[model samples]
Target: MHLLRLRTDVAELLLSTQGAAVLGWSLDTDTGRFPLLRPARHDGNGAPDETAAFPLVPYGNRVGGNTFSFAGRDYQLVPNAGDRYRLHGDGWLSDWTVEAATDNSATVALSHTADESAPWDYLARQLVTLDGYRLTLTLSVENTGRDTLPFGLGWHPYFPLTSRTRLTAPASSVWLEGADHLPTEEVPLPANLDFRKKAPVPARWINNGFEDWNGCARIDWPERGLTLTIDTDPIFSRYVVYRPDTARDPAFAGDWFCFEPMTHTVDGFHMPGMGGLTPLRPGERLEGHIRLEALALQTGYQRATGKDYPGP
Candidate 1:
């Protein structure tokens, strides 16, 4: 497998052929590393670790099989886990072809064929660009299948955790999950999964999805003088928070937590009326964008460049 690395004064990001996934991104000034999406866990050397990295294409945490019925026909996908529902779509695990690369950006593309034997074909492209303290990712997926298929998109980025790390976002409700990790109910935040108050991640395990989130969220590391503000286009409405009990690992204990922005819930396919299933016509495309801006938190909300809000 080939891995591509990109670095700038502000941050460093890694891209891998397997799943054409973004594997790692870290701020240049911070001691902590931001874990990119991967399907299998691996050490820094790129060898597979027992744990899975991040899943691509269909990002965030997706459960259930990758099979769904569309237009009265049931379709099945190659399961990432044998005997289980397909997970994270097929792109993240598949090798993507690098079409272009430059000092400031790179583009990778992949195509799938639809036939009676494997009837879901599409073309996907990912573009990564670095601009000062901000990095932007844009992705597009086009259906090449003769028949329409259901789809969605998202990003899985883990941020470093610190005593001063704080998350601020406007969310109306949160999903309550059953043992299987699927949402059973959508309840108001704070009363349940709220993080607006900047509560330290509890020692107890948490793998829950939330909905009705604003298109923006912020992560502040006061001690490090770093602040990351993430803004997504309206297409991304859901977010998933995962705090794994990595205390036993020692290597990654209290290191990071994931703030996943997704287009919908884990099993949106089974939700009433297929809540998050996006349908694409022949030759049609699905596209989304995410922008991450980094700044230095000063007396109050100052840009890293020392410019004030609405500065000249």
Candidate 2:
């Protein structure tokens, strides 16, 4: 199926039906057009990861070894994404129905039932709206089962990673990944881990989660003379930063980086304080919003007088 397209004066967006994911978002400017999120690399037949952005619903991240104990009973999950743990959630893998669409807004819905590979029965919806230069994505999930289960919501958006791109975000702590792709321990943010000064992507591989995130981050692309700001609701207090290793995924090497605004850490079910999983009773719902604003920077002097101006 063809992806839905949305437009405004300064931006153009592509939304896919397979996962209700964002296929691509680009900014048009005087200098040149550039993608705010990484452009989609595959058709709907490929994995959600190939898209520019996708929703993290019912839960975000892995559940640890495909199993977790909740309210005295045990739940088993099937592994996804080549991991030994249950990755992402059913919403990202299932086809979503387009409930509504307009010039600058659209909504999609997905429903799931508890089965062998899935345990949580719920209904999820995503509403995407664009006003001027801001793109807002609001997501909600309501438990439909008779029993209660832990739930979380978030968004996975990949941004273009160029040589001069710098990211600035604030966080109180970080979870270092261990052998099994799970957090080994929690520690205070170190100098190297700090992004407050707009740091470049680390040369080495990084797949860690940050806790108590300030819910705001700025990504600047100097060469392109563009900047993008990301803002999320408090429900997304945790964030995951990931850049695949070249040897593992050469196709994605240095092309993009994911700054995932999530509600919990990977495999949080196995840890006490790390798990942000909220116990949702029957009929209960979890919801949140993420907004992105893209703007062009004045990297060159005034055309008439060749004079400089202040820049962000």
Candidate 3:
């Protein structure tokens, strides 16, 4: 499948035909990469990264392993191991059609039917735009099924590495995961998980979700002479941090890290009052926007672009 690539004067972004996923996002003026979506593996044909565009739908995480009950009826989705329900959603791997594109942005759309096996037909759209030093990504889903369905949205982006790369948020608690990676407990942020101040990712494995998160996060890359501040409208109350253990994934044996802005925790559908699961009524739509600002740390100049954002 061919991938669609979009560019502006300041940045370049890639969108895959499969799942219309974002493959790569980088600032055109700098060497830093913005969206760390992985590259397609090269077996021989020189293909793009297959797992780059992970679906964040029907639920961001598992639902007890491809099975769940809604309205007293049982629903089954494709399993992604871990005895945890279906992972991400079906859209990530599905091919998406590019509807429109321009020098500064592009829009891709995909539609799926809710059949007996997977009873959640929906229409989804993803728009990516690069304005000045800022890049914005927006996703929307419309429920086409006769019945309401649970849903959520999240973006998994890999950021360029730098000694100054650090994260800060106002999170009070984090979800404890079982061996199977399911939510086991909601514990207060321990001294290690605490990120009130800018802290380097410790030399340990982390694949946990945080709750009670404020709608703001900051990443500073001093070596690149840039600092990115991400601010989401209050709709995003949860965040996920994934730091692969170098011992396990030798490919990423360095200080690289991920800062995921999500609507809720994994399996939030089962969690209580934690922005749990989102339900979209038939013909209803779910929409959210992420605003990113890129500032020249040394020059103190900034620029931004996103939904409803004014030009720099």
Q: Which candidate wins on TM-score?
A: 2
Model 2: C-alpha RMSD to truth? Answer: 3.3
Model 2 clash number: 0
Q: For candidate 3, write residues 210-280 as lDDT tens digits.
A: 98878888777666655677887676788888777768777675556667778877876555543556778
Which is the better candidate, 1 or 2, if ranked by TM-score?
A: 2
For each candidate in turn, the TM-score is 0.82, 0.93, 0.84
- What candidate 3 gets wrong by more than 4 Å, as runs, is 28-55, 81-85, 273-275, 297-312
Error of 2 at 244 (Å): 1.1
- Candidate 2 wrongly placed segments (more than 4 Å): 298-312
TM-score of 2: 0.93
Order of quality (TM-score)? 2, 3, 1
Error of 3 at 78 (Å): 2.7
Give the C-alpha lDDT of model 3.
0.68
lDDT of model 3, residue 188? 89
Ranking by lDDT: 2, 3, 1
lDDT of 2: 0.83
C-alpha RMSD values across all candidates: 4.3, 3.3, 4.5
- Give a tens-digit lDDT track for model 2, residues 90-124: 88888899999999999999988999987899999
